[model samples]
Target: MSRRVSDVMTRGSRALPLDATLYDAARIMRDEGIGDVLVTLDGRLCGLVTDRDIVVRGVAERRDARHTPLGEVCSADLVTIGPDDDLDTAARLMREQAVRRLPVVDDEQRPLGIVSLGDLARAGGVDPGVLSGISQAPPNL
Candidate 1:
């Protein structure tokens, strides 16, 4: 049987507020060694911001980290996964969307956890054929 996404997802993930300062979010990520954080507003999942977002959108833009809010820099139209979804489905979505992380949401759209590419790799459920295909692909080709 295929493993469920929830089985492999990182449960009890930390989240940042949409109105939070970029510097604080970056500090949290650095301290926790997290690549991304879910952006929530009033206890509802609203968007997401990754480490790259801070560099490109905040730093590069010369935006003040102390004043810049997460919502202004986050990707609001986030691609999400359901806890009941299979790992294969999650992987497919990640590949198609070119996103390294996916938020696992409950039926009420409440975030339960997050799944990263590292998690999927560690899960060891990706088919051997798929791994071989990826290996055959050339870098940036």
Candidate 2:
């Protein structure tokens, strides 16, 4: 039987409200040793903000992290999956979306966990070449 996303996903994924500042997101990422945080609005998943997002969209643009809300810089075009989905599905979604992480959500769009490329690697079923491609450093701007 194929493993489910919940089997390897990182549970208790950190989340912050849309109004939360970039600094708040950074602190959570720092303290939790995570690269991204789910952005929520009224308890529903709304977007995602990564460390790179903060640096590129917030800091590079000279936006004050202390005051700039995540809503302003977060990637709202999210591609999420569900806990019961097969790991293969997650891997495919990650590949097709060109995203490193996928927020596992419930029917109500509440984030339950996050499945990362590393998680798929650890699960040991995804194509190695795909993982390698995803792991490659992003090209310079």
Candidate 3:
């Protein structure tokens, strides 16, 4: 009797083009009130950039947000969950991957929605420390 990821995921249109700069990604996130956005290549999910990624990778490293492509800042490692997956699966993935957010995809890998620790918490799920670890800024910052 577990809840599906789709039940609590954020269904916002927040995907960005691969050619877009980090500044574009940040602005979209700021306007949309999202931490991360899915990056697309020819309308397909390629990677993702998050607020943490922006601060840690884009800012701390002195990468020029306006010139640095989102694809450059986005983690090359892509991880995802299905819309039908249970929240426990999402939580476990978050814990194991040390990621705060995950893109919800269908079998064909189409972008559906996004699930995050905050979404789970707002949906009455507990953080359980793992989520906090994911959100914490690096010590160097």
Candidate 4:
């Protein structure tokens, strides 16, 4: 009996349109106490934007947060999971993708929730070393 992703995911994750500005995404992250947000186009998941993305891609690049759209800085190369998937699958995907967060989407690619390293940690099944590796600062950073 494996645990489903929905069992440990953070439901009702925040999302914003691709046309939305970085400031909009940052404001939502601040209000929700979340580090990332799903980026959508015409209500379909298209990309993901994170606090690090805002800092490195948006700020560090000198893009005006208020004028720059999320589509411009969001990570379009996404690896999503399904709510019905097992925790092991989530862990494997995160490891293979070297990503700390995964958007849980449906067959239609509409985001349902978000699964993060912290969420997996609280679930108590994934290996701690794997978690540690994911949380480690990148060599270039």
The estimated TM-scores of all candidates read: 0.88, 0.94, 0.82, 0.93
- Model 1: which ten-residue window has the lowest total lDDT? 132-141
List runs of model 2 lying over 4 Å from the truth. 137-141
Model 3 error, position 12 (Å): 1.8
How far off is residue 13 in model 2, in Å? Answer: 0.4
Q: Candidate 1, 111: how far from true, in Å?
A: 1.0
Give Cα distance to truth, residue 55, candidate 4, Å: 0.9
The Cα local distance difference test for each model comes to 0.83, 0.90, 0.81, 0.90
- What is residue 22's positional error in candidate 1, in angstroms? 0.3
lDDT of 2: 0.90
Q: Cα deviation in Å at residue 61, candidate 3? A: 3.1
Question: Which candidate number maximizes TM-score?
Answer: 2
Better of 2 and 4 by TM-score: 2
User: Model 4, 86-114: lDDT tens per residue?
Assistant: 98899888877788889999999999989
- lDDT per residue as tens, model 2, 62-116: 9999999999999998989999999889888777777888999999999998999
Q: List the residue pairs that clash in candidate 1.
A: none
**Residue 87 C-alpha lDDT in model 3:** 84
